[model samples]
Target chain A: MKSIFGKSKELEKNIEEYLDIVEEALLIFERDINRYLEGQYDLFEENLDDILTVENNADDILKEIKYKLYTYMLIPEARGDVLNIIESLDNEVDLCKKVLMQFSIEKPEIKDFIVSDFKELTKQSLKSAEQLVRGIRTYFEEISMVNEYVNKVHFYEHEADKLEERIKRKVFSTDHINDLCKKVHIRHFSEKLAYFSDLAEEISEILSVASIKRSI
Target chain B: MTSFLFISSGLFLGWSLGANDAANLFGTAVSTKMVKFSTAAVIISIFVTIGAVFGGTGTTETLGALGSVNALAGAFVVALAAGVTVYLMTCYELPVSTTQSIVGAIIGWNLFSGRPTQLDVLYKILGTWVFSPILSALFAIVFFKIAEYIVKNCRIHLFKIDMFTRIGLILVGAFGAYSLGANNIANVMGVFTKTSILASLQIGFITLSNTQVLFLLGGLAISVGVFTYSKRVMSTVGRNIFKISPVASLVVVLSSSVVLFIFASEGLESILLNLGLPTIPLVPVSGSQAVVGAVIGIGLAKGGRNVNYKLLGKIGLGWVLTPLFALIISYIVLFFMQNVFMQQVYF
Candidate 1:
């Protein structure tokens, strides 16, 4: 964080701290979702509480960054772009908390046959987020590496999309689950998980646009 | 007291110069909130005074050569004519040039006195007026390109670039003010020096020349103008005109300063001549024209569609009318000063 924002120490510290909270929430979101896939529903519930707290913390930091930039006239030339990039980054944390809350309340039971596919979707979605983390970190510290990780995010997002489509077709075509309502629920949750990767991809594009106006 | 009254018209023009041209110095920096108004004011006042006291001679020599108004009454009328031209233009919200206005009034003085106008020297001053803006535009284009390349290719973060630019604006603005003072101070105080009416006085240990004392007073008048009236014009230019990026803003300002400094610097001209290059003329170039040219340069570089041709046409009209009006007023005032007052306006 310090390396990425070395010259402007105060703005560097604030934005770095905000990105840290967001990454924290996202890591917990990744871990909790995987734990649920492994049948540790009780432990997932405990992690869900931490994710919610971090999400709120991320929200507060976003507001704080905006206020500081306004009140102190920080980064007079690039303040608008900096605030916008952080806002987009913070949205990912909000999505994580929302997705975790849905899982906690729904508590959908997965059938044995499609367990491997569901886990595969989870891994791809988490990969998108992990690549997003690296892209953002690189955005601050080393712009040369930004395109590298942002490209990976796009690749993982495409993979997540293909997995989601397969899950949808299989669930609707086969009568393995037998209950129509349960089949729709499983399909809806799978699509939502795929949408997680879509969010990461959206953030990557946002970062790209902001960088165009920022330095280059 | 009589000497002060004799120099009052010059002081009036000095005040107007300070008010209007200070916008060129610190307008972008203050308007963008990169520097506070008070901070800009302090820096501008000190530097302009220093520039006037130390380096005000080069361009004054140009104006002095163009026409030597040897009588105090004649110099007084010329300053008043130019001052009135600037005042009228300011009311119409036109950025007028004191250099051009005073040049026109001197031409008017020559016409009324039946003296031969030095067409060759006049042509050189006129040529610079034409090229100042064009040169400024070229400088701006080159500077903008270099700045754009640096921002895009450098490994530095965006926020830090912005911070650095803010600091850069302050430093460049101070330089601009200094150059402005050195060049434009002649428009305010040049005519009065021909009379040698104000004798040198000792202030503490420093025995300043009459010309330097007159310049110091004129510089203060300009400073007073900057403090009291520049904000309104600065705000208007900052918000209403070209919505430029920080880099573009810096490019425009630095470009104008380069042109103004070139016109005022004999040292730079001799260097060019020593290198077997054509020398730059030491003329009183218009700061307003240079800034306008810079803005146009950035506009063209950004694709030219955003150029405000209507306002520019209006400003060009103002530039044309400024000299003509000053010439007519000075001719009229010189006739009355010579005939009714029975004053010897030309030696």
Candidate 2:
């Protein structure tokens, strides 16, 4: 009598709210990246407060989601898997906040040659999140299409991996920048960007396994 | 024995049947609140009667071999003794088998009367009691696999699947209830089959025997038990134990029915006999035990981590104790009835 899908709608809404803030945070990151590349240093500094505000809001929503998940006994069969999904997505959102905060604290120099690659990396990372959100929505609304959206997330993560390798190689190969700390910073930022895609892939894997468990 | 009030003894067994065993048929539906208690009672009462009148005769023949209290006084005492034994044991948190109690009482009667209990028939009936749960577990495992395959290979929407499963559980539960009535009417109606006091009813063109009329009475008593006492059990322990999916619930119902029907069905045996195969023996098995086995089977298929062997161990102990208590009680009761009350239990 206690249904498996009873709390899914509430869970969907919470995840949606979390992802929305993450999306807003990503938009701010894009703006900051553009300002850095366009040589507008003061403007990027001014926009840091807005990204921080949205990240805080996302953190609040994530906290509420965890509280609800832990306290409320929803569907026993789905409770574990749903918690796993929330944890994975929560980690990614925290990473988004951390990356923007890093840019505000330690402003790294962006070379013009890799501006296109930075844009591409950001796009690929967001694409992974995009596919993951869609997949999660599918998991709640019409679970049959969950695999399709999950596959898309995997596809985007693969593309992000390639971009990460190219950006990292280009950062180290540059002759003008001989500072190891600067090179490592550039590579580390790219890795942080790639980490989003990794989380998305993990989400996809978790969803697939959860789906199988539900069927059984 | 000549008074109609004496039939109340058998009715008590019927009520006990409803109290303990009716949950097996409609527990999932009622516990889920999918079907109203009144609706379930009405449906089960109606179907139990129909199943008893039409299909209950086969199993009574087997139970008759186990006991056969031809005297009205003896039949009344046997049923009452079994009912009392079941009630007292249940109160002590022990699992009691009505079939075992009746068999034990009949054995008591046989020993008192100095008549031989046909060893071959008794052995066959005893064998069913041992094998019923095993067969039910095997059936459950097979059915669970089949249900899993259907869910996997089918392209049906999840909502549609949920809808289908709900309806399927109700229908199968009803069917299970019907078979339970048919098979178990033997335990309630067997002693009364050869009762000599009751008169047959004739309605113009149709005629009903005294035994048939007794079965109908027994069925009504069971329905009364379901409406009054069974609901309490359904709302408590039954609800907790039955919190499984539609597929697992269906597996439990279907497998329980299969074992009950197989053990009690003479028609299936005749068919096998005609085909020059080993005929399946007619025996009355415990529905409660069969349901337990079905639950265990699904548990095993799900990796056997959840099966409560300690509880099962307790139940096994009760199974051993049920008949021993009933046998001693019936023998003592029969002795008192014949001596103090000056009643003829045999001859």
Candidate 3:
């Protein structure tokens, strides 16, 4: 019995650590994107390395959590739901890493007019991801609070969507840039940044359904 | 040897009780994989034996008051009749309980031997049959509310809740098994208590009475049944009968176990009497019906959805039909045992 409880505590600690890493990855993504906007290429590259390291750590902890949940048969009733939540939450971390890596590789030319808009869009998108992590944490520890976090995720996701649309409008309509390719490239990056919030919204839907099923 | 042969029918009844009724205690636990079957089986066998030896006398005395089947042949026939009734009902896919069947068979013996059936005792037994399930339901509702409140307020981690629920299931399953042995052993061995020919034996710091020896034998038979046949029944009960959550299953098991314990416990009765409270009679009640009642209680607690009225009707019908069938079977079997087999079926 003590061993079983010990295994559960270990798994719980691993899950908490994994969530922290995912949250850290999103913070790094937002910071590095701001650095890229400011023309600090060296610091952006350094933070990119930091996010990659965090994402890898999150993946490792996720794998460990899954192994323990399945082999030890913890939470038999909610095992599938918990795994689904964890796997989907991992996708958010992956999206953060993907967005940062794309910015590093493409080095898209950001015109002066839409720079503030890009930074705000990244902040809003990361806010949604941050709320999603909180929602998932509430799902584990305090189920009643999960819906509150889910609603916050949806709110931030909506804010990100608005900012994405504003950035796209500014990029296409402004007379600053002459190259059509540059216009399209800015549009692609804006959509990529906003897509993080969309993914957070999708995961919130899953978390809501799982929480309802879990209620005693 | 003849005594063992005569008591075999009672042993058979005990076996069938174990096979069918152990599921009520551990079905959801095993089916949900919250508690392993091997652990449940071991705990059930040991605690059930302990309960039958120590706590079985109250309900057995109640059965004796209803009608004492004084002859070994008569007791054998009475137990055989109840067992056969249960089998036939199961074959027909009808709900049956050994408690009702044994009660009806003893009443049949009363008629056959030209003895007056004690109307007050019969009424008390009948009243308990009608009351036990309802009481179980009330207990379930209260316990469910308490459990829900704790889960909502405690904010325990899901993994920790899972671990605690697993431990709770095993502990509650043990209690249910003990209550089953205490309450329902009367149905298995009550008829034979009057005619038991077993000699008392001394076992290290304990003296076994003849009745306790009979109960121990009955308890062993029940254990054998649990080991051999209860697994499939637990699966059917856990998966098919109701699709309740593990926490709800815990409440159901706990409620029904409490019902059985109250009905079988003489100590509780004395305490109640001393406190000037109306005492619950020591009568054998159906554990399965109590579980069903508890399930219904949960349904009612959850806004009265998906209650399965048709199943409830069938259970009500079984309450009337099981005992009636047992009485007829007992009457006919006693005739053959006395006339054709040339045995003294009654004296």
Candidate 4:
């Protein structure tokens, strides 16, 4: 398809390049979590160790976003919403790193349903990213597309809440949770991931508000 | 026969005015990137020249006749001295006035004509040294504050606001050039008229009117000043002071011109004297000072935080010493040039 970002190939290239990195990092998290479920705990630990490095890469991308956002100020009609959304995405990546670090140090068992819900959140996040990239490109054209990204994020938040309840209930009922440190670590890891979803959802809501204003 | 010299001097003054005062008109716009330098310069030069040609006789009369000097040679000397003084000031990047420089040169030439310095005129003109800036600044500050408040409090779209403000700037620039033409163009023509030089000029069966010849001469002089000599002072006015918006700069110029017009009138000195203050009417004060005063008024209106006090101090020093510097230079140059050696050759 022809690029929707008006005239410049550069902006499209930048957004696509950053999105690829985020997608790669998210896939690695999913693979590692799946390995842990299969009881390949050592492989999971190795991948979890690799997650910290993604934060550094994400941070570098954040700098590029800042430069681009500053450039936008000079170019007319460059909706500033991208600055806040990109910043939130960077924050989500940071929170992801924290959750992975907790997982590496303290192996905690999450229920199958909870794992599926978390995977669904990841899918929603990717969907949100895809919609955001397209929405930004079509910002001057068909601006209504931003609503789909906003809806997906809110849907992911509800999913995250349900998963949190299922996991917490399982941890309480299961005798493996009798270990105090493991229970605490699992609680912290689950809470951090939930927090990331909340932040991502909030970012999406803000972008929706911005898009509404832009359309008006 | 020396019509060429007077015409040349007037063109030089006009060009210098453009180089210098155009910034007063469009400095803020140029600095803020609302307009480019070349665009501003061309617009200002054209308008100012037009202003001088059509609206500049009053000022030419005031400058030309202020100090009584009878001879054509004396008139030439006065114009020559004024021209050189302004040129030197521009060279040194001082915000000196062409008006004051001409007056000072006239005073020098008057002394040579055996008319002792008119202390009454001198004092009244000097008295403006204190009053003009203070008045201009007070009014400028008041106007600037009002303009700023209107811009802030009015729920207007930014683009529309900018468009309206730009229109305001254009009006103010036109007014400024009109004021220059009314008040300073006379400086170019007054000498010619005083010496009966205009009456002597003839072409075929058509004799040029004094006013018409003056309009052309004043217009051309200011154009030359603008084109040749006004850049440094223009830059200084635009950049040295605080970064002003186009709206604020326009207000300052309008206020300055208003204050100058008040002083340029024939009864200004008489009115001041009637008010029990000793004032001088014959000698015109510096427009540069008037502009500075107006700028200060704008600055104060912006509040103390926005005014660059350091820049004011520097300009203030230049204001105090410019006439004295011109007087000394005129004295030295005239003494040597008119003395035993060169006089035999020219006489």
**Whose TM-score is greatest here?**
3
The fnat of each candidate, in order, is 0.26, 0.02, 0.70, 0.00
**Stretches > 4 Å off in candidate 3:** A169-180, B91-95
Q: Model 2: per-residue lDDT, tens digit, B14-69?
A: 89998888777777766655456787788778877776766788888877776668
All candidates in order of DockQ, best leading: 3, 1, 2, 4
> For candidate 1, lDDT tens digit of each residue in A20-55?
887787678778877887899889887667987887
- Candidates in order, interface RMSD in Å: 4.7, 6.6, 1.1, 12.1
* Model 2 pairs in collision: none
lDDT of 2 by residue, A1-216 (tens): 424354445655776787677777667777776676677889977777787688678778878777766554333335568778767776776776788778767877778888789878888887888788777666654666789988888888999999999988998999978899998988888888788888889888998887765554
Judged by whole-model lDDT over C-alpha atoms, candidate 3 comes out at: 0.90
lDDT of 2 at A33: 66
Candidate lDDT (C-alpha), each = 0.82, 0.76, 0.90, 0.60
Clashing pairs in 1: A4-A141
For model 3 chain B, the run of ten residues with the poorest summed lDDT: B88-97
Tens digit per residue, CA lDDT, model 3, B44-111:
99989999999999999999999988999999999999999989877876656899999989988999
- As a whole number from 0 to 100, the lDDT of residue B293 in candidate 2 is 83
Q: In order, what DockQ does each candidate have? A: 0.27, 0.08, 0.68, 0.04
